[model samples]
Target: MKLSFEYGQGLMDATLPDTTDVFIPGETVQDPPFLPNIEAATREAIEHPMGMKRLGEQVNADSKVVIIFPDRVKGGFQADSHRKVSIPILIEECAKAGVSDRNIKLICSNGLHRKNTKEEIRSILGDDIFNRFWDLGNITNHDSEDWDNLVDLGYEEQYNARVIMNKEVYDADAAILVGHALGNPYGGYS
Candidate 1:
């Protein structure tokens, strides 16, 4: 048997034994069109956010904003991808909130995975964002191996695990996580 797997920019066929169990979402499930008008819906969501202050209410000229997004592993390259649609809106809102472009940074939370290449980053962020921030040194990826950029949250006594985060995110005045909410194998939930 052969099955198609979603890969970057395209799909790949994987051959498996005939007796192997294969599960496909399309067989028994259908994902409804959650938000048909992404831009309008995003605007509405920002205007009336649940459990948090609106973007304009929280940021100011002095605020250091950090916008984080996952790499090109999950979100597709479609024009309506979260980064493409929501980022411009977020930037506009931040601007209205008095956050300057120079004070805002874009970080790719690639985590332990390899840093996304320039092309991959471009594809994920689109031309407008990539061109605006790439040359300005305002766009970057999280380097888990860069100890200086990692902040230790101390050891958790209950879980016996130490939590760490990117220092940029740790030090930001405001941080926004923008990405899809669909299922992913790595996190079980996105």
Candidate 2:
């Protein structure tokens, strides 16, 4: 008998450390019956199971909703990425939950990193999702230096940590954080 391994780049690939951990999909785990569809599997892992009917249900209908996601360069983009699955589902879910299209905002969680260009956004979200949201000016960058809108979360004392967050996120009616669960060196940790 003979076997061969072919690795393809996906969301996990962006953040995967340089190592050799054979990811045998069905063969690696034995629990919770197999998922027949990749989209379904993606939903099961990323989106909330019991929270809102869709990711949109968590938002307030009268206010703006912000969806924060890690940059694609940080293990968030792929050829057939879950981010693709998650974003549109979120859009549809938001629509179903009565959140108007104009009220939804998609923000790349770039932090101190460079802003994502239109091309990068397209690459991360694909043309369909990009077309739907970008036209509304719903997509933007995380400007870490914008102190006027940042909220100081006091201090951690031990670590001298004065956590600050974007005021847009703080002022928004709701916030949806989307990211892969892969281990990270920078401690995004979600």
Candidate 3:
């Protein structure tokens, strides 16, 4: 069996033993289309947000908005990619909420993963978003190694582990996470 996974700008091919059994999600799973029109679904979701008020109703002019998006490693770079389709809408809502551009920051939540390069950043976020935020220093990748940018939450006794998050996220008046649900090794979905 053979498989090809994306690695940087190129592809890395892998070969398994002849007797190996491989299962591809598309081939193994059969599910009806839940929401075929992503944009429409997103709009509907925004209209009736759960657990909180709408973006415009929640934020004020003085509010600092931080939007966290997944890195390229976890998602696709297609024209209709989640970030591409959703970010602009989020921004528009923020604008309607009177949150200025200066108060908004888009963080590529790479966590401990390798930092994405400029090209990868452009690929993950469409050119319009990249152009709108990158040059303004509003778009950035999270650096776990940068201690100053990390906020240390006191050790939790339940899991007996230290919890930490990005300082920008911690300091922001509102922090929103944008991502897709996919089967991953870390968990069944993220």
What TM-score does structure 3 among the candidates reach? 0.85
In model 1, how large is the Cα lDDT of residue 187? 75
- The per-residue C-alpha lDDT of model 2 at residue 138 equals 85
Report, for all candidates in order, the number of backbone clashes. 0, 1, 0
lDDT of 3 by residue, 120-161 (tens): 999999899899888889999999999999999989999999
Per-prediction TM-score: 0.86, 0.71, 0.85
Candidate 2, residue 28: the lDDT equals 70
Please give the TM-score that candidate 2 achieves against the real structure: 0.71
**Candidate 2 local lDDT, 55-117, one digit each (tens):** 544655676788887786665466557677777777676777788989888888888888988
In candidate 1, how many Å is residue 185 off?
4.5
Clashes of 1: 0
lDDT, candidate 1, at 128: 95
Off by over 4 Å in 3: 1-31, 185-187
Pairs clashing in candidate 3? none
